[model samples]
Target: MNVDLDTAKEGLAVLQQYGGQAAAAAGSLLAGLASPFQLFEGGWGLNLLFFGVLGLLAYSLVVLAPRQ
Candidate 1:
């Protein structure tokens, strides 16, 4: 296949721009998810509560998953 240099460069630019946007979106999503964990830093009680809740959520998901 014959491809023009300018056309390839334009395609690469578009891909790079899309990748950057995707990275930014992923970063924001992770930051939002992690924001709640910051509360656990206040004390050991909060840390234990956070882990307990997380464990319960994990267990529920496991119990509720579909069986083949």
Candidate 2:
């Protein structure tokens, strides 16, 4: 196998770019979740409402599923 330095460098650049993008996305997600007080103050009750709905749906599924 003929390995070239330029190809390796290009691969590393591509990897760095992907890592940067992933890091940015993760940072945004963390920032969004970190300020719960601000979120709730800013009319984020819908988040909790959605969670409540999800819990009810899960409970209903468990109750309605056939037991072995």
lDDT of each: 0.85, 0.80
The alpha-carbon root-mean-square deviation between model 1 and the true structure, to one decimal in Å, is 8.1
Model 2 per-residue lDDT at 8 = 92
Task: Give TM-scores for every candidate, taking all chains together and pairing residue i with residue i.
Answer: 0.58, 0.50
Stretches of candidate 1 exceeding 4 Å from the true structure: 40-68
In candidate 1, what are the lDDT values of residues 1-68, reduced to their tens digit? 99999999999999999999999999999989877776656666887787899999987788766542
C-alpha RMSD by candidate, in order: 8.1, 8.0
Where does candidate 1 have its weakest 10-residue lDDT segment?
Answer: 35-44
Per candidate, the number of residue pairs that clash is: 0, 0
In model 1, what lDDT does residue 8 have? Answer: 100
- Candidate 2's residue-wise lDDT over 30-61, tens digit each? 87886663434556587678668888999878
Collision pairs in model 1? none
